[model samples]
Target: MDAGAAIWEYLGADAPVADLPAMGYGEVASGYATTHSAESVGIIGGGYVGIETAEAFAEHGLDVHLFEMVPHTLQPFGAEAAATVEDHLRKQGIDLHLDTAVEGIDGAGSVERIGTGDHTVPVDLALVGVGVAPNTELAEAAGIELGTTGAIANDRYGQTNDDQVYTARDCAEATHTVTGEPDHVPLALTANRAGRAIGATLAGDPTPIGEIAGTAAVKAFDLEVARTGVIDEESAAEAGFDPVSVTITAQSRAHYYPGGEEIQITLVADRESERVLGASMVGREGVAKRIDTVAAALHAEMTVHQLSYLDLAYAPSFSPVWDPVLTATKVLHGKVAG
Candidate 1:
């Protein structure tokens, strides 16, 4: 399929029966060929999309090259959490080039090389999943207002500046569920939540949005990495809190349980309030499930003490009586206390 068709499928649209945009696999076949030849692939931008794509491509027998202009992947996730992701990526043979930018992608109508200052790689394909901008040309010509981020400036309920205007997905901003800041977070979950908020308001119930607590996860190369809330240091400070972090390396299931795996978890909290802020986990085991538990705790404004004592279900086949998250919480609580 062509790029447009691929995008349509991604958005869950039915395939065009009559006229489908034809992709030149022959004309553009060089890009695909380069991908097949190179053992290593480089991803620019270490956000959720970049990281997830890197993991997927690496698993398919390609040497994954990940490039991030920031100091680490997942800039919103802060340094400590990014480190856990990096560790997981490294285990999968992904080469992370952080604090670097791709000068350009060079190829003859297909990607053959990725160019950087003083560096060049004969890449099979240069996956430029460096995030995206609002496809707002239609909105602009129609005179819709735009946010500073180039997204549509929607109200708490997803209503744009115009009375009849509503926006979601990559086209709108959302209120931070914790900090109450209006932010343009291009996540599907945010779009859905904002849609609901808009629906409620349209139904005559004016719902207010809280601060956006960014949430994302990735399952790549059999490793699960997930994070939520403000995981970055600057974000915490911007939200008027001093941040403290703790990392825990623990078993996924009971040690006695067969096939149990190891997981690394990191929790970020306010140094003064001891309130849970953001967290991340990485493992070939049950990292996503565990990170979700912490994500829930952060969303509900639960403190470390509360999360530590959460009445979580347990079984040796799935989890220990005290899950890794509970243990991490207990660890964080101790740090907060003493």
Candidate 2:
């Protein structure tokens, strides 16, 4: 939406890796596929990649065994939040196995059995999304020092410790706005922002890089999931703020609108300031757009008062006079004010 040519430069960040291997990027790049003959496929990690791969394998007539070590499906994001997503996942015929961890992956050459601490499960494929380490091998091989998270460390201007080199994307580190700590948040928006700021600096304009708000969105079947700012309770606590959160269900548009859809919005605000710190939304019909609006507000350091008063378009055919996002903001404002 911020189309000042500064932003458009990041519209095309090249996709470097094709498909990920069970092990490393090199194995993936060398054309490898490890599969077995089994009715059920085991997927390790219930994060976005694991769940998506599970759904795809299931559609091809394979029963899916989704292993997530967390008591809830997506840990750190809360059980209630995970349950809403798991419901949709189960409908896709995936066997959601929480509290399960992958001990080892075994096969002669191709994958056959996935080992748990208790026993081994026979599977056609073992998909792992335990998370990713930075693809810093290129930078590392060239003697660019790596950080604790295995990312290429860059200064505020996207310059690596090496002056001539500029890096963005999953390979680079990010400065968290809330905690004032550096992290590796390999998200598209972060990459885009970094690219823009770096491009500006390179093109005769001196723009200082700002803190990243950690916003992201995803689509899982009918669910349009988006989370912006910070949702990690640990991070919130560490950031020296008492975080209060609320969840509400509302229609995407006015109830009177013929095709109105339902969505769930969750908001986190500072207990004392009532300033929105984070937001998550799950539903249909432009859910990502609505979340983006809140994300912008969070970046602008807007309070719930400003969120409630933000000018968002509305029509009986589009949204109620009060959009669901604004409505949720008003709710948080009341809770904080009271």
Cα lDDT tens digits for candidate 2, 107-200: 8876778868686787756667888778887898888877766788888888888898888868888777655677787878678878998999
The TM-scores, one per candidate, come to: 0.82, 0.82
lDDT of each: 0.73, 0.73
Candidate 1 per-residue lDDT over residues 1-338, each given as its tens digit: 36534433332334572175556433344334434455556677888778877865665666778888878887665676578778767877888778788898887855567758677666756666777787888778888898777788777666777888777767776766656566777777776676777788778898644346667777656767777887767777998988878888888789899999888788888878888988877778787766778768877888888888889888998887788888888888888887
Screening candidate 2 with a backbone cut-off below 3 angstroms (N, C-alpha, C), the clashing residue pairs are none
User: What ranges in model 1 sit over 4 Å off?
Assistant: 1-27, 30-40, 107-110, 137-150, 203-212
lDDT of 1: 0.73
